[model samples]
Target: MRGLTAGYGPVRALDGVDVTAERGHITAVLGANGAGKTTLLRTISGLVRPTAGSVHVDGTDLTAAAAEKIARAGVAHVPEGRGVITELTVEENLRLGALLGSARKRTERTAEDVYTMFPALAERRRRDAHTLSGGERQMLVIGRALVSGPDVLLLDEPSLGLAPRIVSQIFGMLRDLVRETELAILLVEQNARSALSIADVGVVLGLGRVVATAPAAELAADDALRHAYLGF
Candidate 1:
């Protein structure tokens, strides 16, 4: 997304934000509450309308397109909450995501492929979604998104409220997925340190604007930046 600007009513949640997520890499978006992290992903995925700027996946312009159209373009978003259907079984929810992905080549990814990536979900494939634990639910949502075989995956607050061990495992798997599949991942996390630890690059947002964009290592090493914007 370049020069992306968006908000609700008159409030500008994002202001002149320019960002990129490359294939085979993970770009982490770090910020405090209300710093436009969620807005960035929403605008890119067409959930929130952009007041200005353009959103593109590859060379195709997706600026202000409908959410369904964007999804068909192979840009999948897994929002903050683990939003699996409580009434459906694990495999049922996974199939729904594939269907939501539109008429993409289904052979690109399968329920078995998702099961391989997340064995925990595979274990309870027939169980109700609500019966899974918090960490398991997080895995399920991510796996569901992956079933679409998206070129770019937008994740919002993936680590929110999870235990440290589970967070580590999930983040590590994301890193492996990017390396192996050459998938571009845009990760939004309030856990700045953890996000930077696994990210190839980091973008810091402050009050509806981008404060800095740098290599994750450089941002992690900057004490002043960490203290001021990251609050770590």
Candidate 2:
């Protein structure tokens, strides 16, 4: 994105922000609460229109495209709070994800691959979504997003409200997914420490603008940065 700007009426959520998500890599966006991390993802996903500038994916401009168009273009967003339908069965939710790829022919590989990646989900496929635990719910949502077969996965706060062990397990799975599929991920996270631990690249946001952009290792090792922006 170049010179991107977005807002709610007069309240600017993003101000001339510039960022990138390279193919076959994970680019993490980290910031404090209300720092426009969610807005950035929403803008890229076409949920919120940009007031200025452009958003391109694989050289195609998407700043003004519809959300469905964006998803069909292979950008799947697993929004904050998981957004699972509590009334639906786990399998049903997975099926809904398949609908997002409605133009493509349905195949067993899609569901099987998601189940293989998230075995816990497969085990509870018959259960109602509301019955699952927090971590399980998170897995379900991510699995649902994967059913769409997106090239770029936009993950928002995947670790929120989960225990440390569960968080580690989920992130480990995500890292493995990245290595196995070579799928690009743009992760918006508040847990800077864990996010940086798995990120290939890190972009730090403050007051609706980028404060730092660097390799994960470099960002993790910077003491001043850890103290100032990351709250470590």
Candidate 3:
């Protein structure tokens, strides 16, 4: 995205934001609460229309595209709050993700890939979604998005409401996935330390604007930056 600007009535959530997610790499967006991190993801996913600028995926201009069109264009967004349907079974939720594309060939390929990556999901396929733990629910939501076969995965707050061990396990799985699938990930996270640890690149946002953009190692090593901006 270039010069992206968005708002909600009088509240300007994003202001002239320029960001990029390189293919086959993890680019993490880090910020405190209400720092426009979620808003940026929503704008890219077409949940919120940008007042200015453009979003391009693999040179395709998606600024004017609808949310579904963007999803079909291989940009899958797992929004904040883990949008899992409590009434659905684990397998049903996975199938719902397959419906995002609806092409028989693509759906079959995505389902096979998702189940392969998330073997635990296959084990609990018959269980009700609500019966799963918080970490399991998160995995289900992520697995659902993966079943869409997106080129870029937009993850919002993956570490929220999970135990430390579970968080590490999920992030470790993500690291392995990036290496194995070569899928780009744009991670929006409040867990700055952990997020930066695993990310290839880091973009820090403050009050609707980017404060810093650097390699993850650089950001982690900068004590002043971590203490002031990341509260670490």
**Top candidate (lDDT):** 1
Off by over 4 Å in 3: 102-109
Clashes of each: 0, 0, 0
How do all models score by TM-score?
0.97, 0.95, 0.94
lDDT of 1 at 57: 84
lDDT, residue 77, model 2: 95
Q: How accurate is candidate 1 locally (lDDT)?
A: 0.91
Q: For model 3, what is the alpha-carbon lDDT of residue 187?
A: 97
* lDDT of each residue in 99-201, candidate 3, tens digit only: 8852322323365566676677777888899988888889889988887778889999999989999889889878887887757899999999999988999
Candidate ordering by TM-score (highest first)? 1, 2, 3
Q: Is candidate 1 or candidate 2 better by TM-score?
A: 1
Over 1-232, each residue of candidate 2 has an lDDT whose tens digit, in order, gives 8888998899999999999998778899988887899999999999999999899988989899999999988888999897899999999999999888724323322777878878888899999999999999999999888888787889999999999998998899889888877578999999999999999999999889999999999999999988888889
**Candidates ranked by lDDT:** 1, 2, 3
Considering every candidate listed, which one attains the maximal TM-score? Answer: 1
Candidate 2 residue pairs in backbone clash? none
User: What are the lDDT scores of the predictions, listed in order?
Assistant: 0.91, 0.89, 0.87
lDDT of 1 by residue, 182-221 (tens): 6889999999999999999999999989999999999999
- Which sections of candidate 1 miss by over 4 Å? 102-107
